[model samples]
Target: MNNTLKVSKYLFRDFKNALLIFYGIILAIAVLMAALFLNVISQESGNASFGGFGFSAFIFLFVSGLNCFKANFKFLQANNISRKRFYYANIITLLSISAFMALIDASMTKVLKLIMPYEDIVEQLYKNDLFFSSFIWSFALFTLAASAGWCITMLYYKCDKLMKTIISFAPVLLVILLVMLNNVTEGALGISIIKSLTVVLGFTNNNPYTAALSFLVATAGVLGLCYLLIRRIAIKD
Candidate 1:
């Protein structure tokens, strides 16, 4: 078998149980939430809505990306796998898992909407209920999350102790700085950024395909950075 294929198979096997356990937990949560909703609806006079479950999957995948690299890299390295092949396998695994989870999320959205007032992120953002559009949007968003997570872990892996600390606080500090700047500008910067994002995401036109394409481009750029970092990364204790 090809080295890349071998690595990919190993990754798939490693994640299989994690994925199943995750969905099992999600299923339990959904069941519990559904029952809660039932009781609430019975008591309430108006309609109730529940949503954002898709975001849970996104968060799960991002954390998965963060945790995937270190141990896997160490194991693969011990087995004499090339870093190039390891990286390739990771890319394939991330994409595959993202798409798989997206499909599940999209289907669940439809099913839940039928049973209750469940609105997914795609529906909230694009205001469209088309299954195909929902799936595409979910796929794009999940892939982006996974890729971004992978890039962050790769950076953490390549950095020293001080650099890791700095990287850890960097996001919070950047947010604070951005907020201060936006306040100084009387929210002009925030508004402008939102406008730009809305345009890039095709919100004004309700075009999810455009947003999906933008997300994919962003993912590609993130993965490209990961490649540069991964190539230089040495196995660490």
Candidate 2:
């Protein structure tokens, strides 16, 4: 109980800092997206509602998790906390931040719908095939991205000189790989993987249970990998 509280406090402190920075970034992005939406509504005579905007919020959350890991790992090490505590703290912090960001995004979307003049814009946004599919995929992508960030941060945590370089470049490399693969392969790989996984899990798109199961599986896998990496690489000073 004491250990949990300690980890929670540490996690909370890190999250406090993250919340401020994340709020600014998300607000700015939201305003920009809103502007783009307005422009689209003006030019195309169609609703500007989009799924990419929501996915961008998730990406920002993942980046914030990376920042928290980089910051908290050093603090924990300096304060003589065990690596186990540090690992748990990181996971707790990441999950908490992700949940908070998700809530903020949902609320923002609702607010936009309420305040904007467009009728049924949100519904139309979800009706689009690309955006609708992305709603299912974004949760998994967000978890994976967060885990990848944690892995990269773990690699750089103990190395002062390489930390900034790795943090800045790793996400870019990952994004580039994903984009190139999607474009060149025509999503064959992605489709195959998703289909296989769905078959293995006995899931179909029509069932909400299937969606929840898929999301849980993806989150568990990412966090499991994150745990292993942290266990292996986290150093005690």
Candidate 3:
């Protein structure tokens, strides 16, 4: 546990500056976007919707995957850090970041609401009216997306030239496959999958906990696979 904490501390310190800078930039962008929305209000328009959370989620996920997960491995290997300790630290760090991001997200919503009490343009797609619910689901998404990014990057590192080539085409192939499946079945597979997920998670799209629960489940699976792949991964020069 002590070692895990140490690992987590080290990982956090390593990226703290970069992460802060990134967030600072994002904050500036959000404020600008909020101002833009306000401008629309000045014109007596009715488009009080803010999808900044989408951008927030993507940044949190991809940045954590690349900087927090993938980059840390190099330093850990050089410092002779234990794989087990690093793994624990990874979980801790990811959860912390996810929680923090969720806080920022919810906070922004509140800030916008406070600044423009009558403005309904600052929209949050997550239908939860409560801050806690919003935070829970946001954390779920952040951690899950980061975990997925970690797994995908790990796979890239572990792949051969041929494997990398195959991976490059995997997305296209996947889309084609799904299209064919949809055509053959004459069913809306994507909608069906979403419905199934909503049912399994015991929450609706409007429910704050819906995707959050599913994300947790999927994150666990992805993290397990990541651990297996990275456990014996060689430290590159």
Which candidate number maximizes lDDT?
1
TM-score of 1: 0.92
Per-residue CA lDDT of model 2 for 1-237, tens digit only, reads 677568767778755866687678767866776687776664676544443445676677667556767567667777877777777766666666655555555456556665443322223333322333333444444555566667666656645667668767887998889778977899986788688876644354333335435666777876776677676565555
Q: Where does candidate 3 have its weakest 10-residue lDDT segment?
A: 117-126
Query: Which residue pairs of candidate 3 clash?
Result: 48-121, 49-121, 50-123
Clashes of each: 0, 0, 3
Best by TM-score: 1
Which 10-residue window in model 2 sums to the lowest lDDT?
A: 119-128
Ordered list by lDDT, greatest first: 1, 3, 2
What count of clashes does model 2 give?
Answer: 0
Error of 1 at 72 (Å): 0.4
- Candidate 2 or 3, higher lDDT? 3
lDDT of 1 at 201: 98
Native-to-model Cα distance after best TM-score fit, residue 164 in candidate 1, in Å: 1.4
- For 1-237, candidate 1 gives per-residue lDDT tens digits of 988988999998878998999999989988877887777774785377778878999998988888888889999999999889998999899999999999999999888877678899888888898999988988998999988988898898899999999999998999999999999999999999999999999998999999999999999999999999988788888
Clashing pairs in 1: none
